[model samples]
Every structure is written in structure tokens, then in C-alpha cells.
Target: MTETATAPAGGLPEAVFDPERLAAVAASGLLDTPAEGTFDDLAELALAITGAQKAFFTVADGRRSFWKAAIGLDAGAVRENDIRDSPCHILIGTGLPLIAEDAVNDPRIRDLAAVGALGIGAWAGYPVVSPEGHVLGGFCVVDQDARPFTPGQTRALQTLARSVSSEIALRQALRQARAAGDASAALARTLQDSLLPPRLAEAPGMDAAAAHLAADATGEAGSNVVGDFYDLFHTRGKNWAAVMGDVCGKGVDAAKVTALARYTVRAEAGQHTHPSVVLHRLHQALAAQRVSDRYLTAALASFRPAADGVGVVGRYASAGHPPALIRRADGSVEELDAPGTLLHPDLPPAQDALKDTTFRLFPGDALLLYTDGITEARDRERGPLFGDARLARTLAATRGWDAARTVDHLRRAVREHSGGHAVDDTALMLLRVAGGPA
Candidate 1:
């Protein structure tokens, strides 16, 4: 077959390759593929347009030369050659395709006996470059008889090469995205596990339990672990203190804040006798950081044993979180009205206040402290929130059970109400007042 140079009317600069572009192309993992229809079509089109006997696509990955697709060449003919001896390798380094009308007269290939032995006298090549300017490979046509390429044919090959480059870029981007997603998921799992205590601390005169559920559909696993956290600890005076709170956002930053808030409450509660005073201390500690935009909504409560006639007393304070639900032994549920403002000092005055409230815990009574994630959980069918009223009703229904049983029922109810899909992180602390202090 005759090899002819078909160039568009005007002479155009040849395609150039660069080291940065080569690196990007090398990363795509597209080289050395078995013939696919897409590449095969391009090869066949190249031969038809250039009127050459053979056409091929070659990718060079530093150490190896890979022929992705080829026409009119034996399958076994596709093999890696020494880069030092390959004239095409030199042309690639120059960032331009080599157009040789006669290999015997071309200085770059004249001394290369392989071209003469293969009966290849004419050659034309176009560099395949990625959008970011990486040279992935080259598309070329060859013939036994020498001829010149027309301008139109050269342009057609260049267009086809660009299409190949785009595919390479798309594949590379997808790989990067998947890798990022995997890393994020691993990080989320680690953060969630680290923030939660390995086991809940048992307290006398109270059956204490905590539950935290993270939304499954939010950002990448490690990208955003909702920052809701809860903890139960004993004070130096033997009273039991519990705190539940949610940081303002999800992800790593929020997790950091959640951890800080949790420890701040525990430390302050141990030093103070009243829950309100403990909460105030936590606010001040957080305020000192000057992170006014990053706030936490929390409930801090202390359970103290009562004297002769009086039952146990639960003193609690709220900072922008949902009010605590108290289930009395009489099968009634009361929403304790606490006074508090959101934790951020810079928030408007209307939102910066804190509320402190008290509740008398009779024998077998239970108290539930939770973040807004529970009440705001959406119902699957109606798209409305599960809401505080439903939470109250649920607690009332489960009031007959002990602390552990009540928490179990409440968790199930919340999950069901949200269609088994938690859209935010939910943290709950349940404290049951036993018949007498243990």
C-alpha cells in the first residue's frame, strides 16, 4: 500500500509532548489494552482517510511501548522496543509527531534497519495528548510506498487523537474520585468510634444508658460524622451526672468540637454541685476559645438521692437542645422546662439564654435527655418530622418499663418513625431512679 501525507490547506504546528503531560497519561492505566471497538474504529478510520496500508495507536509508559489498537499489522508485531533505538521515542520527546516521506532519506530513521526490513517507507504520526497537555501516545499510519499527507487528513487524525485524550482524562478523574471517597469513609468510621466511650459508666440508684446513631445518607463516611455525643460520669459527691449535646456541624471539625464539649461538661460537672452551674462553666470554657460561630446545643443533668420522704431530685439545664422528657412512676410524661440559651456568646440575645429546671424523680421514674436529631427525624410516608409530641407519647407508653427497656423501646420507635433512616446524628441518655439509693 502507498503511504501519503494528507495535510489541511495550511501548515499547522505539530503536536508536542511534555513531562507533566506524560505523567498524567501514564497514570490513566489505559495502555496495553486488548483491541476494543472504539480504538479499532479509530484505527480503521485512520487507514481509510490516510489511504495507508497500516495504522496503529501506540502508548509509551517510560519502560514499555504498548500498542493499544492496530490494523494491517500482525498481532505478534505489537511489542515493546528499546526506547534508545526507537525513532518514534525521540519524536515524542520533541513533543511533535514525526512525518517521514521516505524512511531511507529521513535522518531520524535512516540508520534503523528495522524500518527498511519491515518494508515501511512512509510514515505520519499525531501525538495523543490529554486535555491537561499530557502525551498519552501517538496515532500513526504507514505504507510501503512513500507519499505526502494532505492537510485535511492530518486534521482528521488530530481530531481523533483528541477524542482519545478526553477518554483518558475522564477515566483518570473517576479513579481519583473513588480513591477520595474510600479514604473519607475510613476516616468517618474512625472518628465516630473514637468519640464514643467503649462502655457506659454504671451509677448507683440509677440505671444509666446512652445511645448515639449517625445518619447513614450524609456525606462520605469519614467526610462527615455528625457530632452528637453523650456521656455519664459520677461526681466526687457520689451524684450521677449525664450530658448529651450536638455540635453545630458534621465532619471532622464538628467531631473535634463534640469531643471538647463532652469533656468540658464532665470536668465542670465534677467540680459543681448544681447542673446549671456545670452548664454555665461549660459555656464559659467554650467562649474562651473565641469560636462564637461554632456552638453546641446540650443538656446537662445531675441525679441526686433524696432524704426520708422526698424522692430523688433531677436538676438539669438546657443550651438550645430539646427539653428533657421525664416519665413518672404514675405513667405520666412531663417535659421539664429548663432555662438556657444556645451556647454561642455571639448569638443574638434572644438565642443566647440558658434555662434551668428541676424535676422530682419518684421511685421507678426515668428521665431522657436527647439532642434535636430525634424530634427532627423525618417520617417516611408523610415527610413530616417525628416531632417532640410523638417523642413524649412514645416515652409515656414505655414508662412502665425499667430504664434499659425504655431506652430500647425509644430507640426502636425513633428508627421506625424515621423510616429506618436517620438523617442526622441522634444521642440520648436515659437515667432511671431506682426504688432506693443503692
Candidate 2:
């Protein structure tokens, strides 16, 4: 006979203090750990997108809620608090998103001492769950002024919460790999895949395609774990954003920087339309991390379908990255030049160097964003480099192809040029206006 699952006598699941749930949290390795840029970036993004006065990424057990990252709260003074006092308790109780327009007046939590002690006017949050489906804590925000949050803001907060969940899972995997002698390479591959989106988001009136070729093109697992990434996603309304970046190194450290940069751009893209502004925000995040050896080159594009429905208007920005290539409908390829320095703490201020260059993609036109791998590939070891000239010519030759075909054709060309061997990770993203080839 099957037994029916029942809630605790107190009408809750006992999830907050459940031993299995607590074990999962412990495995995350986030409890009492120092703040990290990945978590800080998420919390900061939550504040920026929601206009919240305070935000926190927390891990909670029965006894207390530990702040992994916080913004606007004095870190030294507000490291943690009793679990009963945190607004996140509501999330743990219901296993659903919680929003209280006025925590001080809400009957459910008004009596809680934290309501008066912390002076929380409003609260909004989503659960941060483990890979095993246990809710460990939450990504939450507090407002000093009691104001209702719009649906868009709440959704944005949810997106950031999911990012928190992913980061926790990555850390757990890394720890497990370290403990298991022969699993390091497998962990590296898993972490590398997590850095990229599983698939590109579809856009109206446009075709988007992307490809990634690992340094080990022979399909040797764990042999290469580099930091080349590309992303395409909707911002708000009809606007969409795309970014391609090459972080400086390999393995876990490179993966950390890659994750930081990717999410930082996503967070900034929703609030800004100018590519330079978005990238500069990412630069600030990297600088805040204060890792001298970690830096990157990136290209960003913000665009929306033109009112005529036959083309797109967009702004492009570059940070120590190669110029993006645009292929006209007439099969002519030209470099869309927008230059800047590397994204590093030692680099000059982004506002002074990074600038947006506006351009339009007419019908049948295609734009390509890529890493240096394609241009740097050589015919053989210590042989002539493929360089920009050949890349431009190859792009020009693909006049009328759709985004997918163009990406495939280019990948083939690079492979042939390098004689079937890859020296570095390669990432290519192509955006084409919906019309057929030129």
C-alpha cells in the first residue's frame, strides 16, 4: 500500500529545517562564504531593475539566514539574522514567490520584530532552489517606500533568482569534482556548458544563429575548457540584445569570469538601450571584482526590428575586441569599427574610451560577431595567420545565405583554413534580416 504524503502538524512542510534540505544547502558550499562578484552582480542587478533600496542573496537554515551577498545593507552590521525575522521565511514556507507591498502593515509578518527593527516597507523575492528541488533560501529585495512592483519588475527579479540557483549548482559540482580524483575534466566540461545559453531566443522578423568550436575540435572531452561565449536575448518591449566575449583564461577561474560578464551584460541590457552603456556597466562589474589577471574582449549589439519590418536599427560597441563585420545586401563586407580597451581593473574608464556606433541592417544584410580564434587560426603551427583580410572575403562570399547556413559555411571555412585543428576556442554569432540571400 502507498502512503499519502502529509504536511507537518503545524500546517507547514518543515522544509526550512528539514535535514535533507539543510544537507543540500551545506553541499552548495555557500553558507558563511565570503561575497563573490557572481552573487554580488546578481544582487546589484536586482536592485537596478527593481529600483529596490536593498537586496540580498541569502542561505537560510532553521537558526539563521546568512547573507551571501547584499546591496544597500551594511555588510559588517547585517551579516545575518534569525530565520524568523527575515522576509525570506515566507518564501520557504510557501515554496512560491512572495511579495508584500507593506511588510510593516501586513498581518502575516507585521508582528515579527524585524518588521519594526529593519523598517521594511515592502518586500519581493523568489526562491533559490538546489538542483535536487530543495529551496535553500531566496533572492530578495526590500524597499523603504511601500510601493507595488509591476509584473515586469517581478519577472526580472525571478530571472536573477534563477541565475543564483545556477551559480549554487556550479559550486556544488566543482566541490564534488575536487573530492573525486578523476572527475576534474568532466567538471570543467560541465562548467563550460553552463556558461552559454542552451539555445538562442527567437526574434520576430529576424534569423539568429550561433556556433561554438572548442579548442579540442576532435571531440576530446575535458581536453579544452576555454572562455568563449555568446548570448542573444530580449531586453524589454521589442528590443533584443546580443553579446560575444572572450575571457582571458581557461578552467574554473575563466569560467567564473565568464559567468560574471554574461550575467552582468544581461542585467544592464534590460535597463539601457545604448550598447556602450551596457558594456561599460559590465566593465564596472569586472573592475569591482579586482582580479588583475582576469580581463576580456567583448562586442555588444542592441537592436530592434525597424518599423518597416524589412530591416533592423541597432547600436554596436566594442571593448578591446576586433571590429564586427557587416555584409550588405549587395555582397560587400565592411568592418563596423568601434574600438576600446580591455575590460580590466587597470584599463582606462569605459565612458572615456567605449562609444556606440549606430548602424542599420537592411533587408538581406547580415552581421557577424566573433572571437579572435577565427582570425588567429593558422594554416599550420607557426605558419601564416588567417587574419582579418581573409575573414572579410569569406563573409562577402556568403551574400544571400540565411543565418544558419552562413554560420555553418563560416565554421567550415575556419576548419579548412586551420587544417582541421583548433588552437583556441571559437564562438560566432550571426544576425540576418529575414529576407533570402542577396
Give the best candidate by lDDT: 2
Q: CA lDDT of each candidate?
A: 0.67, 0.79
The residue pairs that clash in candidate 2, if any, are 400-437, 400-438
Worst lDDT 10-window in candidate 1: 4-13
Q: Residue-wise lDDT of candidate 2 within 1-438, one digit each (tens)?
A: 111112123433467778978998888888888989988988999899989888899899888889898888776776888887776676676566777777777765666666677678988888787655568998989898788988778767866776687577567657666666535556666676766777888877788899998776334423456578898988777999999999887677777777767767765786689999888877776675553357899999999988787699999999989899999888999899797877886777787798999989988988999999899987647577778999999998888988999999999999988887777888999999888554
Give one digit per residue, the lDDT tens place, for model 1 in 1-438: 112223222222133234565566568676656777877888898888889998777787554446677788787774555443444564455445568878777766666544765577887776665433446667778888888888677656654564455455445544654666745544554555555665678777677777777676444422445477787877655577888887776555565565556655654565566777767766665554343357778888887777664567768888777888888876688887677776764654432366557777877788888888789888646488889889998888875677777777888998988888766778787888776322
Model 1 residue 154 distance off true place after TM-score fit, in angstroms: 80
Q: Give the backbone clash total of model 1.
A: 26
Instruction: Predict model 1's lDDT versus the native.
Output: 0.67
User: How many residue pairs clash in each candidate at the backbone level?
Assistant: 26, 2
lDDT of 1 at 414: 87
